[model samples]
Target: MKVDKVASSPIPVSQLNQPAYPQTEQPQRPTSVRPQTTIEQAITATAADQLAQLPDIDAEKVTAVKNALARGELELDIHALSSAVMRFHTGHE
Candidate 1:
């Protein structure tokens, strides 16, 4: 009886010689230290300036407006209010 020969494969050596994969660069974000002020701060600042100008104004009305602005119950536009203030001052002069 005759026996048939089978072909055998050798292990690949290229994988052992391969260099490590290159690392990809990651995107960097900018670092900021300044803390952001809340909307309430802006509203309060504007309201304070308004209150300062109206020294004889009603305390209750000013307090109500300030509270409303701080709680977001009222919307305060500094630019518009400033313009109104300027107009009021000019009218008085």
Candidate 2:
């Protein structure tokens, strides 16, 4: 509780108001420089470009399949289809 008994601070009182080290100007990076693209990004862009060139749906193939189904030429393998679907959902071979 006595002021005379209190220990003095290790740092000088003058240094308390000022920074410990001098501030230096940092070099700025050039804004014109572009970041390099990763391999994954390049592959994805290539895939997207390839996909854009292809048709969304094969109309000719769809029409042929529809005609075949209507003619009863394409037999519906319900058991095999169900088994394949079950395997897909279960992640099994």
Candidate 3:
């Protein structure tokens, strides 16, 4: 049976023995932050109102597409579809 030696660590032994420097001053941080409650509430309410105005689905369009697919009336361009998907994934316009 043969055995191979393990690779040595990349860091030098001298650097491992060095002492870390002490921090002289503490970093200043904000003690208190005031919340903008009214502004946040107004924004949330506006978003909710806009979302409520939107329809979940267009049933007429969905049914038409489904019927066309079932009847073999719809044709798909695979190359174009794949290109569009690639462009979307790569974030190209």
Best by lDDT: 2
3-82 per-residue lDDT for model 2 (tens digits): 58558888888989888798999999898999899999999999999999999999999999999989999988898988
TM-score for each predicted model, relative to the true structure: 0.33, 0.52, 0.36
lDDT of 3 at 17: 80
Record all residue pairs in model 1 with backbone atoms less than 3 Å apart, i.e. clashing.
Answer: none
Q: Write the per-residue lDDT of candidate 1 for residues 1-93, one digit (tens) a residue.
A: 998785653746676667678678887866866879999999999999988888686889999989998999999888888888988989632
Off by over 4 Å in 3: 1-51
Give the winner by TM-score: 2 or 3: 2
User: Candidates' lDDT values, in order?
Assistant: 0.83, 0.92, 0.87
Worst 10 residues of 2 by lDDT: 1-10
Tens-place lDDT per residue, model 3, 1-93, is 998886887888888887788557887878887776798899999999999998899889999999998899998778888889989999763
Most TM-score-accurate candidate? 2
Q: Which scores better on lDDT, 1 or 3?
A: 3
Candidate 2: deviation at residue 39, Å?
Answer: 1.7
RMSD of every candidate to native, in Å, equals 18.2, 6.3, 14.4
